[model samples]
Target chain A: MYLLLDQPTISQSSGNVVDGINLEDIKEFAKAFKLRRLGLGLTQTQVGQALSVTEGPAYSQSAICSALASQMLAAQLSSQQQNIFEKLDITPKSAQKIKPVLERWMKEAEERYASGQNHLTDFIGMEPSKKRKRRTSFTPQALELLNAHFERNTHPSGTEITGLAHQLGYEREVIRIWFCNKRQALKNTVRMMSKGMV
Target chain B: MYLLLDQPTISQSSGNVVDGINLEDIKEFAKAFKLRRLGLGLTQTQVGQALSVTEGPAYSQSAICSALASQMLAAQLSSQQQNIFEKLDITPKSAQKIKPVLERWMKEAEERYASGQNHLTDFIGMEPSKKRKRRTSFTPQALELLNAHFERNTHPSGTEITGLAHQLGYEREVIRIWFCNKRQALKNTVRMMSKGMV
Candidate 1:
């Protein structure tokens, strides 16, 4: 995520700001937020669950996911058009709005962690959401078929994903998410390897 | 990293390619490479080690790391300037060079896996490298302190990282890598949550 943060050259050259908020500041805080969260031994799920309890339905895991994920995603964009898309994109806007919320929540979390882990847990105050989608399980054969398709084309059209869902007897949305997640997982594995190399 | 792949709207508008390689094609191959590697039950470390043997001294885990990591990283960039930077950057160039190597290795591994896991092991063909870096370990207190600092600032610049090393009695490089791994770990955790949310 800080890949965008380290871009002093770009930011300095462009001098772009959104709603009087420096993108650089948001980028910096985001990096700090992740570091702070890990230091307290909290996963994003935990933080999301905790925030939901205090911030109401507005701060669910999906909210956290969309917010944080967008920043990380935005950092990876390398083309002018993609950069423009990011500026106008709802995802990055959502991230911008969510930044202050995350910043405050992290500060509170760090303060609690400073006091003690027990206090930190109390601060987290997990209240499980009543509704959670059941875990999707794909058969080995299904995975094999999916992998074959993925090998051939990583980005399948909506119709293609729907076709896959029909063939696999799973929901179309599930198939869509499977591809999204599969891509994210591959990126992460490479990232870990990169860090190891460094 | 197909997050960037699924973006037809953005890609069509920008239409960027590097080194005569369609970004889309590279993205697809990376996803396929990962899925194939997993299906063969080989970890990135195993693949890295295996490649080290065949690619000689020039192709260590770090080489594999830079190559594969850059493609995934390249897929994520949304800005044209950043895209140009990525192409010029050694990281992506290294990644471009290594892509074909990985593709070949994975093909052979898959053939071996189809035969048997036993045969797959033969394909891995481990040869111990004499120049492996010793792993770093941190004291609980050191971790606590480091976390404390990380909470305050994620990007501590070179001097701050150096200062941390002096205070912790570790090499500056080790401290830097720790932060890098820590950041990667946090991103992975959120990505997992995002997938679950979907």
Candidate 2:
């Protein structure tokens, strides 16, 4: 399902399209999402901050921008590329991922505004986020060991993960997630290298 | 920021409006998301199937539909409620959540199509999803006990949760998640009651 969208276009908006994806639809959504964000009187930075403190993992402004639009290669685009979807800097998949989070947040914010509670605190739930474990700051030495373990084998058994957790004074689940994220990171890195961008 | 958007409108589309959310934008995007999905020759059912087998939690057909449109009460709409934005049934927050997951899956599927690997197998990814954990089916006795505990205290300390896990022979995390989901369900139920639906 991984479509290598980094490459420039081959000009086939019709007939046996690559990925069977409708670029036109993706383009429209991206433009609309941006407009909606603006209409909410919220900036990308503000959305980014609000999302980070809510629930789930934090997303950066760059991530948000990528979901909405990517920087297309100048050669491929027209001199006056007004539409965000003209070149489709961002992929359809990334946009799909981000749209809902932004949508829901904006809706909630608007509701608060409508109710006459136009405060940022009211937008982000007043109750602090549930205590999902605090962000673990891995020391250099710990990272080295973890990296070495990962290099040896990405998929460590529960027992092995538990042993490592005991040794490093971290939770077993944390170590497990670390391995998962590390493998994902490695996979992304390898993919980048293959694309000759590394 | 929980914004109850079920009520009738306050009507302030211009000039420093509260509830600054643009339903028009959300409606357009929802329509666009559907078109893109159709262009890819994928059904909502197919997408739901594909999402279930993937990394994240499974999404239902209702979830998919709600992402695009929800069943709004007749009273909520005007006589000529042609536009989807007229008293949106689905909340923006929920739509935001589902968008990215769908977007990502569709892109992957389209990529598969472009590469001439236009099969469900190819679209769902080559390797099987990593086995994180299976869904636990709690016994009737366990459910009764758990419900009893929940009635007493909606919030259980980690130690208490661990104790329950050991007592019920279930994973601590599963028990914790159950509590979280239960609380959410309860909150949703309360909201529905407030809206005079139940």
Candidate 3:
């Protein structure tokens, strides 16, 4: 169980982060800490001990989940630690990386909770019934074969693609989707270049 | 093999990133992308396709490696990206997640080399040679069991250690080191907090 520490507000002051950090950045990290722990498959109690909170009770799953969703949608609801940034008004500059930032913040929050912090809550903005899309995971060997084939032919054709799939003993569609995702990822990276999106 | 986009000066004279991005961040991402690809088990050409770079004539294994190492380390070396207010000029704060970050960087560098980027040839002034450590990656469940056990009785004496190990079906030393690393992680996190080490 996660220990929710009652945070005392510092200043909600804004300043450029020293060493690439600021309160905004820290807030962003708080979101991430929670998310990463969740992603790491740790329950709140496990997270609490990992962080070392000896005083408080372990976090209930709902409380942890709510804190993640709520904080992402809005800031800390209560006055305790209200010094967090202007709640959840994610700026235009943030890209998809915004979600990862929130996840990181959750990781930090988990860390805080472990230190005997009081119960903090967050609500997921999405419907409880909603399900996230499962991302495609690639295997190292499969990727190598594809890379090798690509290096052999600067611009491969559909036949070539199918042939390689046959050679690799896989269906053509998987190769097709891989190409599609790769293309999209590149586009995003290049776009970041154009927009100077960090 | 990886495609070598014509060598883009990470930035022209003004040093503003080609996009609004800090060059280091993109470079960092490029490395991460390479790692993700490597983790996927893909070769340079495969990664090229994913990024939508044409494979074959322009792409080469060596180039891929160059991009991987250069992009990852450039940020670390960049005074601009390092930190705006690092009074002590120590490691970057982003450097906080050292193990995972460095591991990811290494994986990417391998991919870049396979793709034929020659940029790593002159990376002389960067980080110190890494000291190798032997630590096995633990399954999440195992880590949980260890963390939970520690919470109840932190410094278990000999029989307690053996008993806990016997109960959990773990080696006494594994439990021992889990506590060690757990303590270390907490100390570092707290140290980061006190030093404004975000």
Q: Which candidate is the best by TM-score?
A: 1
In candidate 1 chain A, what residue range of length 10 has the lowest lDDT sum?
A1-10
For each candidate, the DockQ is: 0.03, 0.01, 0.02
lDDT of 2 by residue, A1-198 (tens): 001121233444433112454444444444455555545544444455466556344343223543344421211234364343332233445445665666566666666655654344445422354655434557577788986676456678999998887566455677899988755543442322232211
> Candidate 3, DockQ to 2 decimals?
0.02
- List, residue by residue over A52-126, the lDDT tens digit for candidate 1: 676664344555655565455444333332433333332334445655566567767776667765667568776
Number of the top-ranking candidate, with DockQ as the measure: 1
Of 1 and 2, the candidate ahead on TM-score is 1
Candidates 1 and 3 compared: the better one by DockQ is: 1
lDDT for each residue of candidate 3 in A1-198, tens digit (9 for 90 to 100):
222212222435554333223334335545545555665455554544332332233434444444334333222222233322222223212322333433344546556555644433222212233355566555667777765554333345578779877877767877776666544443444344334443
TM-score of 2: 0.27
Ordered by DockQ, highest first, the candidates read 1, 3, 2
**Which parts of model 2 are misplaced by more than 4 Å?**
A1-198, B1-108, B111-126, B129-135
Candidate 1 per-residue lDDT over residues B79-175, each given as its tens digit: 5646534232333454566666776676677666666545455456355634444354576878888866654555569999988876665557779
Our model 2 lands, by Cα RMSD against the true structure, at: 29.1
TM-score of each: 0.31, 0.27, 0.22
RMSD of each: 23.0, 29.1, 25.3
User: Quick one: ranking by TM-score, best first?
Assistant: 1, 2, 3
